[model samples]
Target: MAISIDRISKSYGEHKDVHALREISLSVHTGELFGLIGPDGAGKTTLFRILTTLVLPDRGSATVEGKDVRDDFRDIRTMVGYMPGRFSLYQDLSVEENLRFFATIFHTTIEENYELIKDIYVQIEPFKKRRAGDLSGGMKQKLALCCALIHRPKVLFLDEPTTGVDVVSRKEFWAMLQQLKKQGMTIFVSTPYMDEATLCDRIALIQKGSIMSVDTPENLLNKYQGDLWGIRTEHMYKALQDLNNFPSVTECYTFGAMHHAQVSGLQMPAELHNYLDRKYHKNIRVEKIKPTIEDCFMQLMQADEREPVPNE
Candidate 1:
């Protein structure tokens, strides 16, 4: 296994002890592009920190490349490259200097690992003489990636690497990741973007410190259990409010330009059309639509909320 986490849990606070992770268990295989998909405050960062051996989990254990995170942190540090969610490169140093500094820390020279970062480094090479702080968001990200790969670590851990990057930059970053995966390097990345979930070989949908489901994006979308309809009207905000009052609508929420409502039974669509007609909605459209990963995530979260909690 590239990484193995068993029943890992973490909490913080002197008196209240807020739970960050709830007995999370997962495994990633060698050279697989595994993703931990979830929103903020869902314990993605905490889990990454544990796996990277930066912080200790309050309970349970984890391993990276067969080296225990607790017992062999030194070994794991040498074998895994990490790019945290935030940009952490030295703002004062030139781009090339930053890369060389990290290379020195790992006891390797950029010349020794040039091939590993050639494709990524080339785009930012012209700006190598510029201070790291002066580069654009995309350039900074590329530089950070070059620094991370300087030593050619076997496993790479990227914690939401594309969070603040521009759309084009995000696309470019993922392309670089794909190139790395093809080279037989293990990669475990986390992201909150539902669209990016489709790019992974397999994904684990995480929410509120729990694992809701784990499968390929296709499987997860296929597992969607209800007839979903995209409701469009002139007034989107009002339409969303009306959807909640819909008798057959089990779930309703806004989705981009339109609102999506999960209705029960086949007859619900016709009934919804008539119901909206009575409300005098213009250009009303109620059509069955495909569910995206975000829809699946909302379904899982709602189902979890509906589940009755056991008494202590």
Candidate 2:
């Protein structure tokens, strides 16, 4: 395994404890692109910090490339490249200076690893002389990736790299990540966007501090609970309550542009349409729709709320 975590846990507070991670255990295979998928405050950063040797976990153990994060902190620090969620480059320093500074810390010059970063660095090369603080959001992200790759570390950890970038930049950034993965580098990345989950080789869905599920995107989608139907009426808000109260609806919630109702086997689209038609609803549309990662996440969250998951 490139990364292995065992029953890791962390909490903060003096009088009242606030848990950030609860017995989180996950494994990333060698040279694999693994993603930590969740919403904000899901302990993604806490796990990253533990693996990167930035902070010690209050419980459990972890290793990166067979080196213990606690006992081999120095070796792990030198062997892994980490790009934090928030931009952390020296804002006053020019792009080139920031890159050079990071390169020097690993006892290597920009020339030594220039080839590894060329594809991404070239995008921001034109702004190499610009102060880090003056660059656009996308440009800043590019520079950060450059600095992180400048050392040519064995394992890469990126925390929400596309959080604040433009849509085009986000697309470009993932493309760059695909290129990097092709080069055989192990990457562990985290993002709150459910849409990004499908881009990963495998993802761990996390909420609060616990991992809800771990599987390939396809496998997760295949496990979506019940038959899903995309439903829309002239009055969406008013119909929401009606849909939820419908005897055949196993689950009902508004999902972008329409309400998604996971109905029981006894209900058909036409039956649902007729039921709503009797209520004087107009322009009703009910179609069985494919579920997305967001839908899977919602299902997991609802299940967790109904019954507490036993720790493994």
Candidate 3:
């Protein structure tokens, strides 16, 4: 295993304390691109901080390539490259300076590890003299990534790296990650974007500080048990309200241009559709649609309400 986390938990503040992670246990195999899928404040950042040795966990243990997070933090830091959610580089320093600075911190020169960052470095080299604060969001992200890879770390940790970037930048960023995996590096990235989950070799679906399910994206889609339909009416609000009250309806929520609903039982009859059609008093469209990862995540959230206890 490249990464092994056994019942890890973290929290913050005092009385009326907030529990960040609750007994979260997972492992990432060597040279795999693993993703933690969840929304903001869902313990993703907390988990990354603990694994990167920036913050200590309140309970349980974690290991990176068999090195304990708490006991062997120094060794872990040297072996892993971490790009935090927020850009923490020196604003006054130029792009080249930032990359060189990090290399120096690890007792290595940029030239010594230039080959490792060659692919990503090429994109940022043209703006090497630009101060980091003057760079665009996408450019800043590239610079940060190049700095992280300069030391040739064995594993990489990215916390919502593409969150605030443009669509083009996001695409370019993932391309860089794929190239790294080919170089035999283990990557652990966290993101709230559902579409991006499919790009990983394996993903952990997480929410409310707990893991709902973990599997290959294809397997998770295959395991969906309920029939889902895309439904839309002239009065969308009323349609949602009425569907939620229906005895046969298992899940009803707005999804983009239409409302995606799940029936509690197998095969919704035409008569049932007619009933909803008349109730809405407008021409409605009801068609069976393949469930996406977001649909699966919604189903998981509706099926459970238990909050994670610290280190359970």
Candidate 4:
């Protein structure tokens, strides 16, 4: 394994009551592109920090490339590259200068590791002299990734790297990751976007500092156990409330322009259409739709709420 974690736990606050992570455990294989999928404050950053040797877990143990995180801080630090969720590059430095700084700190140079970051660095090379703070969101992300790769580490940890960037930039960023994976780097990245989950070889869905499920995106979607319906009416809010009150509806939530409702039986769509027509007397459309990763995540969240995990 490139990374291995065993029942790790952490807490914050003076009373030690805020449990940030609860007995979380997972593994990433060598040269694999794995994702830790979650929203903000989901313990993704804390887990990344612990894996990169920046913080210690209150309990349990972890190893990176067979080196214990607790006992081999120096080795781990040298072996892995960490790009935090927040932009941490020096604002005063130009793009080229920032890359040079990171390379120098790692006892390497851009010339030596150019092959590792050429694909990413080329995108921002025209703005090499531009200050890091003045770059656009996409350019900033590219520069940060270049800095992380300049050291040419075996394992890479990126925490929510696409959070505030534009859609095109986000796409480009993932393309770079795919290229890096082909180069045999073990990449562990986290993101709140469910669509990005499908791009990874495997993903671990997390919520409120707990692992809800871990599998390939296809497998997770395949495990959705109920019929799904996409509903659209003139009044979305009212339709949502009405669907929630229906006895056969197991789950209902607004998804973009349509409301998705999970129901007990396949024949419920016609019944739903009629109910909406009689109640609201407006144009309504309800169709059986395929389940998505977002649907799978919502279902897992509901299950977790129904049976809360005890704090360690």
Candidate 5:
């Protein structure tokens, strides 16, 4: 295992008691591109900090590359690269200067580890003299990645690396990750985008500081329990509310312009159409659709809501 977490928990504030993480446990295999898929405040950042040895867990244990995070903080720090959620590089320094500074901190020259970051560095090299703060979001992302890899660590940890970048840049960033994975780097990345979940080798869907489920994207979709139908009409909003009030509707939510409804029994398009005709009296279309990663995530969240929480 490249990373191992067991029953890890963390909290914030003494009196207010904000539980940041709750009994989280998961593992990342060596050379795997794993993802922590969740929205903000889901404890992804907290878990990453713990794994990178920047913060201590309130309970449980974690290990990176067979070294204990608590007992071997120094060793772990050297063996892994961390790119925090926020842009943490020296904004005043030139692009190349920032890279050089990180390389110096690791006691290695740019020439020594240039091969590790050459592909990423070359993209931002044209702006080598540009201040880090002056670069665009995509350029800053590449620069940050280059700095993190300057030392050629075996494992890479990236937190929300594509949060504010353009769509093209986001696609390019994932392509870069694919290249890194080919070079035998164990990558652990966190993202709030549900579509990005499918790109990972495996993903842990987390919410409210607790893990909902962990599995390959394909497997998660395969485990979807019921048939899903897409309903679209001129009155989308009202139709959504009406579908939610339907007796047979198990789950109803909006996806783009259409509303996806999961029904309990084998009700075809005609039944749905007839039901809508009787109520809304509008020309509505209902088609059976395949469930997506977002659908699986929504189902997991609903299941979590029904689960009972233990007493402290």
Candidate 6:
């Protein structure tokens, strides 16, 4: 195993009332691309911080490559690369300078590890003389990733690596991760974007400081136990409101141009179509659609409850 976490928990303040992580247990196999999928305020970042040796867990334990996170933090820090959600590079330093600084701190030189970051580094090399603060969001993200990889860490922890970048940049970043995985690196990433969950080998859906589900993205989609439909009408908001008010509607939320709905009881799509058409004078289109990762995530979050992991 590359990563092993056992009932890890953390809280803030002297009162320790805020539970950032609640008995979280997980494992990441060597060379696997694992994802922690959740929105903001979930325990994804907290768990990443613990695994990266930056935060102490109040209870339980975690290890990276068999080294205890707390006891071997010094060693763990040297072997892991971390890219926080926010850009933390020196705004005053040039891109090249920032990369060099991180490499030197890891007791390695850029030339020694340049091969590890060559793909990502070359994109920013032209702007090496430019200040990191002056780069565009996408460029800055790639630069930050290069700096993180310069030391050739065994495991990479990326917390929302593409949160603010453009769509093209997001795609490029995932490609880089795929390349890294091919090179036998263990990557643990956390993202709020449900679309990215399907790209991972496995994902842990987290919410309110707890994990709601942990499995392959396809499995989650396959296990969704609700009738879902995509709806479009003259007034999107009004349509959603009216749909929610309907006794048969269990959950209704906006998704892109259409609103997705789950019915309270089993009902055929044709019956739903007729009911909507009768209720509203305007034509309402309803189509049965396959559930996406976002749909499954919304359903899991709506439950707001985590299933207990059996004791081993």
Estimate the Cα RMSD of every predicted model relative to the unseen true structure: 1.5, 1.6, 1.9, 1.1, 1.1, 2.7
lDDT of each: 0.91, 0.92, 0.88, 0.91, 0.91, 0.89
Comparing candidate 3 with candidate 4, which one achieves the higher TM-score? 4
Query: How high a TM-score does candidate 4 get?
Result: 0.97
Model 4 lowest lDDT segment of ten: 263-272
Query: Could you tell me the TM-score of candidate 6?
Result: 0.94
What TM-score quantifies how close candidate 3 is to the native fold? 0.95
- When summed lDDT is taken over every stretch of 10 residues in candidate 3, the lowest stretch is 303-312
Model 2, stretches more than 4 Å misplaced? 309-312
As a whole number from 0 to 100, the lDDT of residue 148 in candidate 1 is 88
**Candidate 5 positional error at 101, Å:** 0.6
Candidate 3 lDDT score at position 183 = 93
lDDT by residue (105-215, candidate 5, tens digit) is 998889998888888888899999999999988999999999999999999999999999889999999999999999999999999999898999999999988999999
TM-score of each model, paired residue for residue: 0.96, 0.97, 0.95, 0.97, 0.97, 0.94
lDDT of 3: 0.88
lDDT of 6 at 60: 98
lDDT string, candidate 6, 1-312, tens digits: 999999998988788988888888899999999999988998888898999888899999999988999999998999999999999999999999999999999999999988889999899899999999999999999988988888888999999999988899999999999999999999999999999999999999988777888999889999897788999888788788788878788789999999999875756777777766776637678898988888888888777644543332
Residue range 225-296, candidate 2, lDDT tens digits = 787899999999988989888898877899989999877675557999998998889999989999999989
Tens digit per residue, CA lDDT, model 3, 1-312: 999988887878775267888778999999999999998889999999999998889888999989999999999999999999899899999999999999999999999988889988888899999999999999899999988888999999999999999999999999999999999999999999998999999999887667889999999898887788888778989889888887787889999999998875756557457868768548778888999998888888877554433342
Q: Given candidate 1, what's the lDDT at residue 108? A: 100
True-vs-predicted CA distance for residue 163, candidate 2, Å: 0.5
